[model samples]
Target: MSSRFRLFDRTAVMGSGYIFAMVNRMQMLYYILILPKHLVQPYMIVGILGVGVLSQINLFILAKYLTSNYFVLGYRGFVQLFSEKIVRFFALLGIFFILIKVIVTTLGYVEIVHQFMFPSMKTSWLIFVLMASGFYIASQGMEKTIRLSIISFLATIWVILVYIPYFLPPISEIHHLYPLVPGEVSLHSWYGLLMVWSALSGPEYLVCLGPWIGPKEKILRGMSIGNALSVFEYLVLFVACLLYYGSPYLEKISFPVVNMIRYLQSPVFERVDLILISLNMIYFLYLIALFLLCLYGAIRIVAGRINIKTNRKGFLGSVAAVFICMLIINGWYWREG
Candidate 1:
């Protein structure tokens, strides 16, 4: 909220909290929707693993820095090393960065919903409902947001387990992963693999959590564990995609992971993917709420620089000010796209 420049929740942040934070953040990227397209058939598996290893380096670095003696410096303390002008520049830049990220992610996810679930509904209405939910959660403060994340993580994580059928029988295409020869592995192949590395997002941004983590928590270690879990999750998902859909068909699917889930037939229901996405609604909402908090931090920085201040009662307005940009972007994008 736009109260006093509060740093983090006074409540304790545990190791499990850090793990779930990183897990939810990384999962929030919606990589399962678009990542398979970035990767080609041959080396995609290896690259996803490579992404895991390389991304950890970033996690460790963020962990290394986030371990401040000052009990996890919020953005204010993190910016002290820079001049006032640089601080202003970073604050402004961060605001734009958060705004852009929120806009793009919201629009993209809404489009996916429109494509699969709500083809008959108005996109504007969808955006309104989404932003309203986000505003409510974001205004409540990070404590609720963190709790929602843990709950979302636990709820949606089962979807991963339910995909076990993908590994066997009529689905498995592990044979397509053969031919790891020198001639077959070209530079472009490696480049496509490298592209998967970029899909390994969210961990590098762990530094932003410095203020939110509990005092006694091993922020770095928890983050590292989260990164490991994230990497392993991606690896499993990528391989599953690789084996299930092969090369030619995989590139054709925009949301291959979801598509794969759509085929899942449980004993209780036929279209288990619908249930998956339903429970998964929390993870998506958790993603939006968490990002809103981060955007709040950026807005706080800008407000401070401009000598503009708001009282604790102004938290809702602050949330609105931050999210209005996203609403505009979504409207414009709906028109354009």
Candidate 2:
């Protein structure tokens, strides 16, 4: 394959293909139920919708600028393309940043889980499962993984559509949604919204998307639509949760999104949050796979450039080992009593 084509394939194929498997039955339940805990009712609806919109726009700008600078413009006449040295530098940097973000996020999640669900569950087990899956999916290549993502995304939507009515009855007090903007929005509120903004940014997989689509115009159009839909979905769910659970109660819970669904109970269904947790796991797994792919691909390029392909496996293995160690270290700090 041509160098340009290989790079393009690497970027676009990996993250999205597995989207179907990304969210399993449980994660769909969780994403629908748990994520709304931070915002007030219908207003949270507005907030998250806003978050989705802003995030898409911001990400678009970021992706465009980054791609142009890195690939097209060529920094200071120091071209990075096809140069093993530059690729290795970037790969290492990527691994460092992603490790920091993943470790922190995973630890925070573990802390939340311990405080809420399965207090006795060892944190190490979570780390092990995540790392194991991360290694497997990432090693498998982008094409195979993205197919899973497609199925997972569709399955999640179907499940949510089926459960819509469960949240309808308690969705009273439409008046609570009257004032779109609350009185004297605090600095804390503004800062809190930033986190939501960042969350909507999605993964760096968009970097790969640039090459896969090839034509900038087509890639731009698709990304715009995809980002818009993502924002809409988040907003819709946020509003639904707000209408169902008042802001006062919703704000108190850590994973209010999942708890939102717990209110839904039938004679046949008990503790729907259990199912939601499973879905959340899939989302988390998706992120893990993404990080490892970027890390390993960079490693592969670096190894190939040095003509040390013979030890490529060992180099990639070390990359995983390092991430696993980071997970353990961060997990300890975050999980500490």
Which candidate should be chosen as best, given TM-score against the real structure? 1
Best by lDDT: 1
Local distance difference test scores for all models: 0.66, 0.53
Compared with the true structure, model 2 gives a TM-score of 0.74
Query: Backbone clashes per model, in order?
Result: 0, 30
CA shift of 240, model 1, Å: 1.6
Stretches of candidate 1 exceeding 4 Å from the true structure: 1-11, 14-16, 181-191, 215-217, 305-324, 331-337
Ten contiguous residues with the weakest lDDT in model 2:
1-10
Candidate 1 lDDT by residue in tens digits, 1-337: 3555442454655455745565545644655567776665656666677777787787666656666654365655656767666776787787676666667667777777776788899876777777778766766667667667667767766667876788888879778666443345567666666656655666545555655665434665666677777767776777788778887888888788777888777788887766666676676676677777776666666666334543444455656665676667666654422
Give candidate 1's whole-model lDDT: 0.66
